[model samples]
Target: MQKTYKVQDDEPERSILARLITPDQNPGDDPLEELHGLATTAGTDVVDELVQRRSSADHSTYMGKGKVEELRLMVQKHDADLIVFDNDLTPAQIRNLEKATGAKVIDRTELILDIFAAGARTHESRLAVELAQLEYSLPRLKRMWTHLSRQAMGVGMRGPGEKQLEVDRRLAQKRISDLKAELKQVEERRERQVSARKEAPTVSLVGYTNAGKSTLMNALTDANVLAQDKLFATLDTRTRRWNLPGWGTVLLSDTVGFIRDLPHSLVASFKSTLEETRQADLLLHVADASSPTVFDQIAAVYAVLKELGIEEKDTLLVLNKIDAIHNPAILNRVLDRYPNAIPVSARSNKGLGCLIEAVGEALGREFLDIAVEVAPSDGKLLGYLSSKGEVLSREFGDESTIVHVRMPAGAMGPVHKSALSIKPSTLMDEAKAAEEASANSSEVA
Candidate 1:
């Protein structure tokens, strides 16, 4: 990867950022912060930024004629080589804008694809990004070859340019089909891998890009999964074992981050990459507490989850990067809004214990606390208790031994099969009923 904010000569791809805003929408302070970040991440030197107030995009150029002239002047002033828009544009609009501004123009979707292309490290991620890029370019191929001809073709085209266009279209479509089939196989394999781990408690980290999820993963499990401060720094999924203090071992997974207005093709292509998030028992929604647009980023993440049909999954809101927020009021405001959200700084290790305990409580909601009395010679049951549950304490008597343990609800069947008599303090009615009955038990203790 290129050094961030490197000297100009290395990559002189100077760009001017542009966006169209509308009334009844909150632009907030610095409406272009996200676009600026994206452009910088794609290794473009942002020369200047321009905004226009419009009810809707102009049909021909997306930007109006007057604004186009102004943009052309601005580009000339900055000697910009590119113009990046925050809105998705039709192919014709992109062509018109490029012609009007005398600079190469790319819309938000294309910019995001470029970033994904740069950050793709793994083979799976590279394939997914390539698929998305191909999908985005399939429709724009005509404009790319525009210099050849502009005449409309009718009743069996005859020109060499049109013939090449047809050839390119066929080639792109074939490649797109091939990519889809390959990704489908990847998705199937990922499903099997995730399903094999169904017996373990699985938790996945999900959030907006650059939200400190990788940092948290490293802090929790020493995953060493490439934690960085840039957006979309890591584009692959990584799973590791996290020991939940008293709750045995659990599997924790990290996935590609979400973004606002994420390209639909990219999301569909990355279905295999998102398999872990879909199959997870619980999701940790990490967010940056210090960002002004934190709520917007949070909403964007949910939108992506909804697209994946997992919006209803059990999720814990984790407000990360708490150490970066110096103002108590900002965090207090967030807490006021989301009272149940856990705040923790993955960098400073502040509040991590609380986060872990909260996770324990969430995963152990169906657990049962019981005291089982058994013969002193029953080492088999004792070993099971030690392995499957957390043994709180023990009592020794001349005739019997009583062991206090907290275990999953599923473990009750085996313990009952062992013909053990017990005192039960489980919260649910089912456990209570189970404790009250035992054919082999003389009485409930």
Candidate 2:
């Protein structure tokens, strides 16, 4: 029989210190700093950090007995109430650590889940977070029965503890099923909305958390999304119409940000929201231009995108927060590394025109230059074309109006269905016609 350990819930504002054990092969990659940031965002003050280099984690304790003892001393020295591990711990490991250290123990996954739980604002996000929490807590249910373990020593009481565990597991399983069913309905509704917007181009902002994606989204489309200098500040998917000059209105969306070692359960639960990224015509892979680990952050984001099977999608590397960098050489170095990256400061609106131009250029590739003739009385078609495309010239005749416009290839379905004469035009022909008309006008003058 395993020893049962009780975990005392600390005050909400208790101080926490994190621990990390890096493998021998990966000595340089430390996630403690990021974990500290997560702790701060979760409203806990980090008192100190402890790191150990080991060939591998101990199966039962996550770290060797010596390291656990060292951690216990550090916790006492720092007067920390909670200990956060940079890696996920098994149920037994958690229990063992709690009993050994006599402190509340949590792992990276639980920390992130707590952040998500606090930041979840919408019905969908709240349900997603709840479902993820339930899924994560399911396998760890045995730890919850630690108090009852002592009472189950007698034969008659032994079965009740096991039976209660089974009952709780069944209830959790049922709740998980119900949540999945509800989320499925929400996803179906979202899919219908996506289907209706198929004619418009969509661009989604995706990047590591706190990479200024929300700020960029607000800058690009004037969306009032909550933009804070904190991780996972925005969880709800926000879509707004972005009017690109010379191109047309595009549906731009800002999604929940990704992070290093993002929990699998959270990923699974947020798949519906992240599907917006997968369905986008273009992905703005935003990165923090000022962070020293910008490249690593980019890699982490790409890893998540790859998991979503959207790695090969058309992506524009948007290096944001350039204003925070003092040295031009640093920005140049980043640009040299990613030669095609668009550098911008979302807060100050620097280089926004170039960003928009790049977006227009990417979206413009899908447009077609066509000429159409419609009756002047057909204001609906004219308004639709003017709103959805760039009308180069509009000529009014006695019977009809000839309008040359550049529109998305897919958007022509409605124009064809309408009673309008449409034909494809070449750029060279349009240029020559304009030049010849200008020459004739000069000769007449």
Best by TM-score: 1
Candidate 2 residue lDDT tens string, 134-203: 9999999988887764454555666556778889999999999999999988887776566456447888
- Across residues 84-151, which tens digit of lDDT does each residue of candidate 1 receive? 99989999999989888899999999999999999898888988999999999998898967778645
Model 2 alpha-carbon drift over 4 Å, by segment: 1-12, 24-31, 150-157, 366-445
On the 0 to 100 scale, the lDDT of residue 66 in model 1 is: 90
What residue runs in model 1 are displaced by over 4 Å at the alpha carbon? 1-9, 150-152, 366-445
Q: By summed lDDT, which 10 consecutive residues of candidate 1 come out lowest?
A: 425-434
| TM-score of structure candidate 2 | 0.78
What value does the lDDT take at residue 30 in candidate 2?
Answer: 57
Cα RMSD, each candidate: 9.1, 9.0
**lDDT for residue 422 in candidate 1, whole number 0-100:** 73
